[model samples]
Target: MKKFLQKYSEFMRGRYGVDDLFYFLMISTLILGLFPNFLLKNGLGLIRWLLFGFGIFRYLSKNFTARSKENAWFMKVFRPVKKEIKFLYTRIRNIKTYRYRRCPKCHQQLRLPVRKGKHTVVCPSCRHEFEVNIRF
Candidate 1:
């Protein structure tokens, strides 16, 4: 096993192995292939296989620069989506205890403690102040 791993690592020296795009492709493939629609299933099945095959090809290919560029581009598109999902998840987790607000100037999300009556809210990111009544 040690010998095999060493050999495999050596074989993959100049190749681009795993990256964020690879994981995203894999997860998207699994999700798209999970639905029950026959047409969608077949189409997504092909897409999934293509993505998997492409990832494997990338892993074995020695074109490291192009593969790295592709991964960077994918991350440029994927980070915001990931952040939004995380924000939603945290908001849901703290739904009853806190309220989520966005700063009008900077569009930054703020988590305020839930309370009754009127209060002034400050946007930490932009240093903008605003007032809101938390009647919950």
Candidate 2:
């Protein structure tokens, strides 16, 4: 059993690296169609499906004998949800776009949008008041 497990892990390691694994998992999650039961319960299944579809595209582009331009063209033509999926994927992939801001009055950590500007922000956790100066 131990040998079998080790061999399976090795095989997977060779066939699919970290990125491929992530793509596979995301696709499987959508295929199972159980996001509503656990991960997303607010009718975000379409978004999830669109993201998984994008993952399928990315995975195929990497492993299959297809040109990058072709893959990009496919994605451009499909354009799942046009705005929602793209927005969600962008937010998920962009770590730099998400920042942790602390409220001055309560010191509670708040998620602030990234950009260059000052805006009045409210903390839901502690009901704190603060101003966020986002610089790009």
Worst 10 residues of 2 by lDDT: 14-23
In candidate 2, which residue ranges exceed 4 Å CA deviation? 1-94
Encode model 1's per-residue lDDT on 1-136: one tens digit a residue.
9999999888878777888887877777677667638636466556767877887787677888998999899899889999999988998999899998888889998889998889899898889999878887
Q: What TM-score, to 2 decimals, does candidate 1 have? A: 0.74
Q: Per-residue alpha-carbon lDDT of model 2 for 68-112, expressed as tens digits?
A: 455466556555655667766766786586866668777765767
Superposed on all Cα atoms, the candidates' RMSDs to the truth, in angstroms, are: 3.1, 13.0
At residue 5, candidate 1 shows an lDDT of 100
Say which candidate scores most in lDDT.
1
Q: lDDT for every model?
A: 0.82, 0.63
TM-score of every candidate relative to the true structure? 0.74, 0.29
Which candidate leads the pack in TM-score? 1
Question: If candidate 2 were superposed on the true structure by all CA atoms, what would the RMSD be?
Answer: 13.0
lDDT of 2: 0.63
